[model samples]
Target: NPLMQPNAIEKISYGIDEAVKATGLGRTFLYERMASGELKSIKVGGRRLIRVADLMDFLQNAANQRIS
Candidate 1:
């Protein structure tokens, strides 16, 4: 049903605030990961764009980790 959903291209860009809301991550935590090069982002004009694919990649990677 994903194809039935709106396309990402139609959404334009995903900013930090949107990412934060989508991931429920704190601003500082997200920014820290970005600063540490753990997360990748794209900059378009004055806004940062994190693709839905990239975010899914990040989540999958994070989920793969074993927290003991």
Candidate 2:
């Protein structure tokens, strides 16, 4: 089922909901991280979206943090 999950790779960014699912984080937690700058996002017109590269970077940094 994990492999079947859609990654939405056709786009450069993802909306908040997609991010929450991909990251397995609660909505509040994700929003909090966004506010704290742990996770980066961009506002386009009226919607907030996270870049694919940024998400990967965030996970990598999180892994590094745990290792250290």
What C-alpha RMSD separates each model from the true structure? 3.3, 3.5
Q: CA lDDT of each candidate? A: 0.78, 0.88
lDDT of 2: 0.88
Error of 1 at 48 (Å): 1.4
True-structure lDDT of candidate 1? 0.78
Q: Candidate 2: where is the Cα deviation over 4 Å?
A: 1-9
Give the TM-score comparing model 1 with the true structure, all chains together: 0.73
Which ten-residue region of model 1 has the weakest summed lDDT? 5-14
Model number with the top lDDT: 2
Summarize candidate 1's per-residue lDDT along 1-68 as a digit string, tens digits. Answer: 45787663455446899988988988888778878877878888888778777777777888888553
